[model samples]
Target: MISEGRYKNQKAIIVENENLSMSFLPDTGANLASVVLKEENFEFMVQRPEREYRRVEFGGDYVEAECSGMDDMFPTIDRCYYERFPWSGTELADHGEVWNLAADVNVKGDDRVDFTFHGVRLPYVFHKNVSIIEKNTVRIDYSAENNTDFEMDFLWAGHTMLQAEPGTRVIVPEDCTCAQAVFTDSGRIGAYGEEFDYPVYRDKDGSLRDMSVMGERQKDSEKYYLKYPLTEGMCGIERTNGRSFTYRFPADRVPYLGLLQNFGGFREMYNMFLEPCTSPFDRPDVARLMKKNCVIPPRSAYDWYLEITVR
Candidate 1:
């Protein structure tokens, strides 16, 4: 059965069943909001304004994105302006042809809660399923569906923001590396240098001590394809004083990942963003070049999935 509850002054919904026990924040402006699995003590916060927005936070565990929410230029959080369909209401549905979508919530079991949404024109749909089992570990599944006339341009980029403190180190698989940092504007020093082969290193002072100069790679500006190969399926950020939370994505389904950090400010400060994107930003042209962007066949459906397991 589904029930209503409250936590930290936020309104929430609870779902319970034999296999799962889930919780959700219905009043928040987040797409999927908060979720907890029955078998685990770990809870997943999809969009918590208290911590930040457009970013997911794993409580007592780890923070996900770097600079989440609408870009500083666009501060409203009503709907995702970039989404093919944007919905501001509490229900999910097909708004129309002009990029309108909805956020829908459902209870499948006594302890399981599911959040679903659809993007028209764009060959993709988002589904987040959370189940609480028993070991304080919550099972989270994030899936995207393709629903278009032809294979469509696709990217599952998540903007997660982490709180900054000393001794924080961003980690990735030994085999995987980061592309050089791209500056949104010119004149300022970029976060990481121009090399795309090695992991970007940072010291406690938050300086790019390894590389003297930043490299210029306009792939996203030209066509948008930011991806790093992950054969092991796991990477993470660790805080020397606190705990480390490993971020995992299925390698078979998601082959590309992006890491961003905004410390001090967009110009300077200390923050890290770990993104898993199916395609790069604003590179519709590259999608055609690489044939990486998907096109949904007329009236057909395509589905994909990702999960976050905290320990």
Candidate 2:
């Protein structure tokens, strides 16, 4: 079944099965978007938002923002501000504000397509859209198009938040190395000048704690890359024991993946932001310096995919 509603300034799409219900909010305020697949003893919430943060709290589940403002979404050691190209005068508002649903999406069951404004860009047009293909393994395809005549820069990242606890552990394919952690507060540190191999761990009072606390790192890297064929993606925090879940993105389409941890104090709420992007945040100047930004030609189309499966 399918249902539609409005929450704040955003629009939501709800899909359900015999055992579960899924909601998709195109607006940034609805940070927790995508599938809510549940069956028997399993339940999972997959998030795919541009930016998500909270106020008056160090960590909880991030509140999606209406616009890119100082107090809106807060970037973490894992997730950061994703800026698209062109130039609209406003930072967060650069991508436009409305989510346009294709007429066909109103129909229910299995196959559906939806498009979002994704904000605005000055001289050009920037928008992100998702297409859902339902099956044993549901498919979510993403794409960002440049409607203008000039080349545009694109930064597509996923702020995937997960719920966790003290006993919660992460599992990633062994060959995958932990990339440097980018803190929103400290700007860019660690691998200041170059990219290096790093492992995933926790910081106690700004110091690296015991690696064992990170659970077991996979011994086989090949198995990890098996899911993501084009680029190397990491999987941490296995959900086998605790209330855990997994989200997958097309490795070839989304070259990078980011895993984030958020502790809710009582039960421990963790978020794994699986970012699929052409570049990382380091300022436009830095992106230009590193030659990391993707130059999307006008009138051209680029496509990507994300999948959520709850067991």
Candidate 3:
């Protein structure tokens, strides 16, 4: 049923059933605040303690907001120049403009909830629907429609930052391949642009590091983007306590998978993200430069969906 709950100081809508439950905050970028597996008593998404939502400054500065929950990163992830100045000539608000703007929640109940946001900086409307499909499963469907006369380039990703314990490990499909490192600024144990089989990576110091398990490590962060046309559209985290959370999607629609591990590197908390993306790169300009940005035709709509399950 749909009811009001407190997400820190913000109000959130709670939707649930006998097996699973979810919370969403419309004011704070329509963030999926929490996903709970009732039987297992596990919370899949992370929540940054003592964080408050604030407007993201014009240049993608993300210091004002919390890093928890599942947020939609769209339009542009990195800073890019807009030919037209709706406000500023640059389109860069850290993860994107969608995360700060308030979204309208139109439907809410035990089975499904639909929310939508209209972009102020870009000419498009985004819609997302979350539904309970099975006892241990939930599906999230997304669509973006261009409202402008010209084509636009953008990036989209499921910023699913998950909770992890010391013995937790991320599992990718057997045939999945990824780069040694993607986010260069986040510090890396390996060289940039080197290709590696999933899980095992070759560090720059000629050392082999296993990327799967979240062992006891110092302050360090690593990120990698899965190459286009993935062999399989599935990945998950198996907790040390024996619980598992998995995400499945259409490989053709979601072409990229990203692994983000921050082991006390950026903050005091240790968290991991198994991101499914429509585009490969995080930087909008870089993605555009590398021809990896998604192009939406004028007056057209794009749609896709993914499923999350616990077992």
> What are the runs in model 1 whose C-alpha is more than 4 Å off?
1-3, 6-10, 13-102, 120-125, 133-136, 184-194, 200-227, 267-270, 282-287, 290-292, 295-300
Tens-digit lDDT track of model 2 for 1-311? 55676433456665555645555664432234444445553444433233442222222223432211111121112222334434522342222122211122333344453543333323333333333444324445555566667665544554444433345565555565545444322222232343334343344246553321332222211101111222444343455464444556655555544444333321232333333344454233344455655555788756666565554
lDDT of 3 by residue, 1-311 (tens): 66678777788878777887888888766788898888877788887666654445444465556778788888765555653334346555677877777778876555777889988777789988878888888888989998777777677888888989777988888776566467633455445555676677766676777878886656777778766557688889999888888999988887778888878776667888888888876765566666766777778988889898876
In order, what lDDT does every prediction score? Answer: 0.42, 0.40, 0.76
Clash count (model 3, backbone only): 1
| Residue 286 of model 3, lDDT score | 66
Taking all chains together, the TM-score of candidate 2 against the true structure is 0.62
Candidate 1 lDDT, 1-311, residue by residue in tens: 56777644545566445434444544332223333444454333322445333323211111223223211110111122332332222221211111112347776766567766555434355566656554434445665555444444344454444443444666666765445444433313233334333444553356543321212232221011134456766655665544444556676665655555443444243444555544433233343455555433445543444344433
TM agreement with the true structure for every prediction: 0.60, 0.62, 0.90
Off by over 4 Å in 3: 51-60, 83-89, 184-187
For candidate 2, the lDDT comes to 0.40
